[model samples]
Target: MQYTMPTIFLASGSPRRLELLKNLDLNVRQKKLPFTEKINRRLSSNKIAEEISYYKAKQAITHIKNDEILLTADTIVCKGNEILVKPRNQNEAFEFLTKLSDTSHSVITGVTMGIPNKLSTFSAETKVYFEPLSKQEIHYYVEKYKPLDKAGAYGIQEWIGWSKIFKIEGSFSNVMGLPTHMIHNYLVNWQKS
Candidate 1:
């Protein structure tokens, strides 16, 4: 008998996450979830990520087949007590970047994977430190990169991350949106079981 791995259906719109999975040599199919991401301001930054990812996974599971596993993820940036989600406009991006200048922020990514009634969830955190960014530099990045779609109004793989971010204390892939190391391990163990 030939055994085959179950198909993984990625229920996220993030191209970066898809790219990371592909780079890790995983078999994945992207499926956009109709669920809209809504943050609960009452939860802690870490809980917020987990809850969102869980809800996303819950929605995606309904559409998956018995031979497929649904995967959902959410990433958030926290500066001090503030949770910085995707910027609504250019001005908001500038504000977010300005606040991140010369400070450390936490990037938390929550992941959920499962079939029908069974599920597994986890979160990875990365602390990113930024060098002092001048007003000119922040403005330039906001205009050039147009990071309105990214949480914290920045992409860790972009120019701002290259020049402004000085250090990071955790998983790089977590900051990018998915914690591939953890995901890889989970997938391997699940296949063995």
Candidate 2:
């Protein structure tokens, strides 16, 4: 019998994260967390994201071997002072999209890397500006895209993003879900140091 060292463990179930990592050509494993608590908007978005990422990473650590690196991330959308999480239903998704239209919001993604006794955590924030959206457009997107599983009720890689996003002020991959460039740089350096 032989054992192969796993490259990395992705502590998330998000298809977007998996896709991003795959795009980077990184060999990784996916580990889903059992419970995700709703983040309190009263806390800073950066803090909330980091805390959640740490929690998820800790939960996944038990399942991974000490030699495998575990990675976890948490993303959230903030408009003004409000933090919009995944919608509870269609109506909430519609409402969230409506508010996001014709406005500027910030998307924050926190990432954690864990290896045995070592853990590193960081966060990336991207400012996204949206053009004014018509009522029909919002409705159509909500019904068509079914953004209930997405934060801010939308995905930057989707139809709305292609047509409505006017500008992005940070890492585009961060907006997608994971900050691949940052992660790649960190991992490369980690391997070297």
Q: What is the C-alpha lDDT profile of model 2 across 1-193, one tens digit per residue?
A: 7423337788778899999988877778887778566676667889899888888877777878656788898889999888999999999998998899898999999899868668899999999999999989999999999999899999999999999998999999999999899888878778678
Worst 10 residues of 1 by lDDT: 1-10
Q: What are the TM-scores, per candidate, against the unseen true structure?
A: 0.94, 0.93
Residue 175 accuracy (lDDT) in model 1:
92
Q: Clashes in model 1: which pairs?
A: none
Deviation from truth (RMSD, Å), model 1 = 2.1
Cα lDDT over the full model 1: 0.90
Tens-digit lDDT string for candidate 1 (1-193) = 8544567889877899999988777678897778888999899888999999999998888878777788999999999889999999999999999999999999999999988889998999999999999999998999998999899999999999999898999999999999899998888899889
Question: lDDT for each of the candidates?
Answer: 0.90, 0.87
As a TM-score, model 2 comes out at 0.93
Poorest 10 consecutive residues of model 2 by lDDT?
A: 1-10
Q: What does the lDDT come to for candidate 2? A: 0.87
